[model samples]
Target: MSSMRLTGTPSWLNIKQRSARPGGGDDPSRGPQEPVRRVWAIGGGKGGIGKSFLAVNLATVAARAGWRVLLIDADLAGANLHTCLGVRGGNRVNLSDYLYDRVVDIDKAAIDTSVPGLRLIMGALDHTGMAETSRAQREHLFQALRKLPVDLVVFDLAAGADRATLDFFLETDEGVIIATPEPTSIENAYGFLRAAFYRRLARTMSTSPIRDLIREAMDRRNERGIRTPADLFKEIGQLDRGEEARFRQALEDFRPRLVVNQVRESEEIKLGFSMRSVCRKFFGINLEYLGYICFDDAVWRSIKERQPLVLAYPQSDAALYIRRIVHKMLGT
Candidate 1:
């Protein structure tokens, strides 16, 4: 956890950890994994929001951009990132293999895909509920992954704002939340931000007097006007003066990037602005709208052909949009 937050602004993505190899030299290639790691976890509030698609293209684009990329199919429920990258399951070892005893080291699960400089550590090959991972297992995974030799690690997380998902989202160097322009999708996205915001205070509130306010707020057991984070914090400042500042500082580390996908018109693209405004109002948070993606027919075609849009049709609208996002993420 000491290496969790890099700094303010884009310093979050500049995480670089160097450690002595087991043998003693500063050799970066001696370990089973990378010397340092930058994990970008892609998640959303609801399902079918193109999380995997965005993840695939980002990995492909970053790989083509000359960075060693490792894409993990962290979508434990339906781990299908391999299909997007066109990596067959016959010969490759997945996270299931590592978790089930086929491989002890997580790095050994990484395999080079068709995309140059890109590799994958796929999740449950059979998709038999890998989401039930214990926190200890996730911690172990994080520790092992942070030591990888790769430059970037992209985790395609599962849907919803569950604790497991939030933990993964928080642990990463960068967190990306994908949402469409639909009303339901937008509401879920807001719900996710609310959950993440409260989650930021959870560890502290569990013991502080803020715990009662949160519990009453959740159960409607109190009429303290704690409908929003701002209201709750106002109450907290009255209850424990210094804890309010501590709680605020805990939330400062959470800077999740937003992406409005499936946009058909320029008007729909502005949903990011509205969403960002809503996040600030409801959760007292600011979202970095990285960019938007147009809804492309070629996306479906790529899915049908089991090829990544960035590779199959580089000039396609979806491919270009994904490239822009990748560049923004890389700060290049």
Candidate 2:
């Protein structure tokens, strides 16, 4: 029998516990040595910014390039990613089934697409309640994604700044934020990043007195002029030197990449650079400008025909743009 020693400290202050990746070590599809997996979540501030379109075509292009990819339609309320991939009329296990426990395994629902190396775990748009996934379910699903055998996992997430949307955005290894040159889209894109930053900080410093300090900052944000990250950092350091390093580390690690879609002019392309600079100065979060895509009639034509753009028009300028984005994404 062992004597009970006094243990009165925050769990985080003690040894940090990492969540185990379920079945990730023995990936049956990839055999003994599993390849590295990359999970990319594509989201924008608004709809019609071409999040799903880019996601589907990128998956197709990557598959054509001889990489195994898995595309998940993360837009629970409006999951047309299956339609964009031309997956029609199949009674298959979807995200709903997995979430509701109709299926115990997530990989069991991965359906093969026309693209040889690409598989899809599709979502549902008809059941509006599907969007309200619990935090535990989301965490389990994310872990399940890591267990999949595919090299790349692309998530076409819903557009918004809601907790669900931002949760998916931050939960990924890296986030790909899509935005048009339009003013409203740009504004909302900033809004999304801002919310993500706060959410990250909130969760990171959740243990008091750091947690208590952050809560007070939130309550008195306007009164104390703690608007920018710089202001918050200064005040936090002044109050407690111990918490500053942790806060700085958390700030440095929240890097999100960007993509400008439907760019028609040089002026529009400059918006990406502008947004990057603004983020650095204001939020203190490093934003990588991945690249941009031009507006093309061929893309519209392909969409109207309900075909994957890269498959239908492989040599189109739009296809070349998609390839470039893929190269930069994989290179980074």
Candidate 3:
């Protein structure tokens, strides 16, 4: 039996502590709290990259290991994660209910799943306004997520590099980017990383003059010609030493995990490493290659049956790879 466990204060808790409100450490819930230990957000630049498949199976695998898990569909645009988890949605309270104040408690939106120790909070299905959630609303939702009575919370974020999507990706402890071995997918993945990297840098700069420069660099067509993060850092180093140090710290701290799905040939399996190298050389980012899942017929079959692959085909090659990825995330 695997002795791997994911319970306890997460490695990123120290970073959270630094930004935590003063004297806001205690849980105010009525009873003992089952504080969420880790959060994983699975997202990509484009749709159809198997993000939902990966999220559902990862949540299922963690739950089966006796850890309480909450799989939330953060994809407000196309909320089908309920279907992926084989849960029927019929007027059940969901994320929008909590966001829009229909439900005061986020726990009310939790729906029981077939897998024990696992629950789900469905995403907005019809609320078009959810895509434009205000910053306060997003922060409230994130605070509630930290207090959910589960060991892990996995967010199935929407596709694209929109501000809302990048915020969700940055807020989580583990930000996973799923992509395929196709040229278009790779291009979009790079775009997504650039957007996210700049977003993080902007958030790190507090009241600094370089903050405006970061914003300008976000626009690729800016007259400053600051195309990459390296170029921006070079400009910042010439401007202010204090801001330059902040930029260096943020660059070192921002590490996003990557997983290539539907991989087939050996070269495709090596795509993760190639991307990692390119990120280091071109973007000065440390991208962790968190293993990949091979192309398998069982993946689609599980989707067709509206069941998580780990549950529908536990013995399938895809399931095996998914479990391995989960273990890697757990650092076991």
Candidate 4:
């Protein structure tokens, strides 16, 4: 059997074999600590592209592979990830509760799942005002997450490139942008990347005079007639070497990964590569291609059953596709 180390002890999950009172009281003997885990945020600009579906199944697959996984439903406004995981009870606390009430510690809100190696942190049901988290709140949430025990933490983010969404996306070690083969999905994905890049650059220059200059250069009405991020970077290179270096480093370090879903034909698969090219040429962004998932009836069936496809059909093409993605993400 495969086994992987986890980071922190989840409040919800109590591994039967691992839970023992050392002194037959509240105090317990100190033992070995789990290794810190990596956090990944899965998002897409447009809705209905299967972002939640992908996030749930991916976490399930990781759990099956013997890695303790914590799946966070970061989609505040329309948080349905609980339903996807077959959690049918009321949540005492959620992301909204933590955001709105400083007294509520987010760790107290985690929920155990039927799966052996997986746990879930539900998001806000009515997140109308909860999405407006200050920078301090965001940092607080991240700090709390760093203490969670899991080999992998996946955040199923809302579908958009709004300031809040972009902030959370940038906070994670890696972000996965899910897109379909459709034209609209592709266009929105590009727009999402542009917005994220600009937001990061704007934040990076919070106290610098070059911030205004960069903003003007990126503006559509500028004399340079720059419409794309590549054009803006080119203009910066001509003006100041320091600014150019900063811009280039941002572009290189902000390498977001891509996953093409619901693909059918070989031609449709080609769109993934074309997107990578367009991103490099027009946007000057290098995106890691994480592979594609073919349209499969079994996937829909698994969803209907409220189970992950990797568990329902381990040998199916869709499961294999997910395995490849995990491999790529792990660089194995």
Q: Which candidate ranks first by lDDT, i.e. highest?
A: 3
- lDDT per residue as tens, model 2, 1-332: 11121222212212112222312323445442364366788987688999999999988877776667888888877888778777883576688778778888888878898889899888865666434888788888878877766777888888887777777888774788999999899988988887777777777774576666565555435677778777888887987776788789889898888888887775676777899899998779888787777787778778877778898877777777777677666552
lDDT of 4 by residue, 1-332 (tens): 12111223223221112212211112344332442356688887998898888999888877776667788888888787887778864745677767667437666777887777788888777746325778787778878777755567888888877777888788774788989999899988888888788877777654465677667755658886878877777777777788888888888788788889887765676677788888999888887676777777777777788777788777777777776677556543
RMSD of 1: 7.7
lDDT of each: 0.76, 0.75, 0.82, 0.73
Backbone clash tally (model 2):
0
**Candidate 1 deviant stretches above 4 angstroms:** 1-34, 90-92, 100-102, 204-223
Task: For each candidate, give its TM-score against the true structure.
Answer: 0.84, 0.85, 0.89, 0.84
Q: In model 2, how large is the Cα lDDT of residue 198?
A: 70
- Which residue pairs come into collision in candidate 3? none
The clash count of every prediction, one per candidate, is: 3, 0, 0, 2
The residue-level lDDT of candidate 4 at 283 comes to 83
Candidate 2 lDDT trough over 10 residues, lowest sum:
1-10
- Residue-level lDDT of model 3, residues 263-302, one tens digit each, is 7765687788888899999999988888778788888889
Worst 10 residues of 1 by lDDT: 1-10
- RMSD to true structure for each model, in Å: 7.7, 13.0, 6.7, 9.3
